[model samples]
Target: MEELSPTAERLVSEFVRTTRRQGAVPSRQVADRTLELLRQLVSEPGWRQTAQLVGQLRAAGRQLAAELPTQPAVGTLVCRLLKMAREEHGAHDEVHEARPHGAPPSQVDSLHRRLTAGRGAAPAADLSSELTGLRANLLAGLDELQTELDASADNIAREALSHIHADDVVLTAGRSATVLAFLRRAARERAFHVLVVEGAPFGGGHRAAAELAALPRRVHVTVIAESALFAMMARVNKVILGVHTVLADGGLRAPVGTQALALAARFHSVPVIVCAPSYKLSPQFHRGDQQEGFLESVSPESVLPYADGALVGRARLTCPLFDYVPPELVTLFVTHTGGTSPWYVYRLLNEYYDQQDHEIVQV
Candidate 1:
């Protein structure tokens, strides 16, 4: 139940404020900021043990999730960091136990042992030095994590050519930087037609089309209405989209119109490809779970303008921000690590996260 440090408190407040006001912030940016803030928190000097640091991090994570319940990136990155700390601590312990008794730290072949050679039952006078070494290892691991985050988009984009082909028709809805980069990379070498469904309420598809049209490639872009998605599905060769989070069961929590689009693609026998980085993978299962904050709703003004007083007062408008696309609808998932089947998501989740920290943020 340790409280967050002053630095952690300030950073978390700023992130929550900016995210609440500008809901358009990309998940990648949110994740990067979250990781940076966590790195800063890990560097602050007052921790006596790994458990204390973990508690403070969990508190900051809960605070972020409470402020922005809809954004999964905040919680995902927090859990990942927690796992990293635990892994480093475990490695430290293993190395310490494996080393020869009375041997100098430098003689140990393991990098972790060489970093810190101290028993878990060390005297109080030596605990500070032990923690200091552990902190250095954790900071180094975070640096590597930051590098991975920065390169995730490009890594996923590299596989675009493998799926998209010359003269193929690609259908997508909404704006996803990962999806955009994937198409951009494919269009550079292959000539393809992109059909962008104008996802209403947000109209993110319009912006997607504009950016695709501007790409310096032989890519032909077309903007289609959401209502026409079903009619146009027959002609699409592949449906490439992006998601906000990949649930543990392999289902997707994607843009609002994604379910309809996936259904249409399935009916037409079109392959549906989802572009997402490994960080978007969550350990939480959405099926049959009564998690109150699982989904989010936005202002209905875009769907039903308040200016139309007659219908506004009579009709109850609900515009959900996301859609749930079951794993069956997804033919393939293109992640930073490469292509994976929807069924394989569970394996990736296991690799990226620890089971113990799955419910770190209860809300």
Candidate 2:
């Protein structure tokens, strides 16, 4: 097992403590912090090879994942950084090695080929000499990733006009910063009505409605109870929501009641569009048997107040913070890059993450 440096360990520990104290930190904020930590780790002295840096990052990622099991963004960002480091190293090695001028570019082998290939010890190399310019390349890659993260909301907002149009009644639940940006951008040109289902216990939808109503542009906003979601679905033209994490199998781990909202949209034949960034794409699969760790339970006091003494002592209350919506219920995912169907999530995962590093945090 590899160990984390003193700086890395201290940073990881502080992050865990902060997140624990202040629950439900936004995924984007978590990703930004994680990226900065990785930048510091890369710039730290004494790393002679890419492999050493990768090992330290893996260790730090596992620590974060263990301490903050609910925050998948931490693991996702770590996996991306690992891939970037490997690519930078590979690019350097390819530059040094000689190849035929007319040789075709190497093809990415399919999973079938990888499975059938014989397992053998990887060739060892003295990467210490090959470390020239690797740090600069990695820093550049990190800068590019940070830029992408920062611009994700704007990029997704740019496509709002294509999805939303004049006189369309948009239905949404919970308060998502990305969803708000999307709607606000569309309202600049097109006039539309927004129906917000008040997310119970938290009332995030009410906040969303208030914010939308306060916008300078004209946007009709209505706050409805969760019970009215199904009734209002028939009149809704589209359903747009934000996600907590996008699972590998194209499923959604979103705020509670999102599954019901998607079901209502599907019943009415309305499109369910999810506004999320690429960093929220998680490579982990959520299985029925793994609910113990994957599903988070917050305080039950919100649902069953302690003032109701008799019920509080006798009745059991489980306040799950999220719901899982399978791929079949989701129509499309609107990412920063562009729109993609649920079925193509695996390809995005392959592009953003390395296969071997997918389970780095799990280890």
TM-score of each: 0.87, 0.91
Which regions in candidate 1 have their CA more than 4 angstroms from the true location?
A: 1-7, 94-129, 288-290, 361-363
Every candidate's lDDT: 0.81, 0.84
TM-score between candidate 2 and the true structure: 0.91
| Clashes per candidate (backbone, < 3 Å) | 0, 0
RMSD of 2: 2.8
- Give lDDT for model 1: 0.81
Best by lDDT: 2
lDDT per residue for candidate 1 within 67-128, as digits (tens), equals 87667788888888887776666556644677678875434433543355564432321111
Top-TM-score structure, candidate number: 2
Model 2 residue 34 CA deviation (Å) reads 1.0
Backbone clashes in candidate 1 total 0
Q: Which whole-number lDDT from 0 to 100 does residue 79 have in model 1?
A: 87
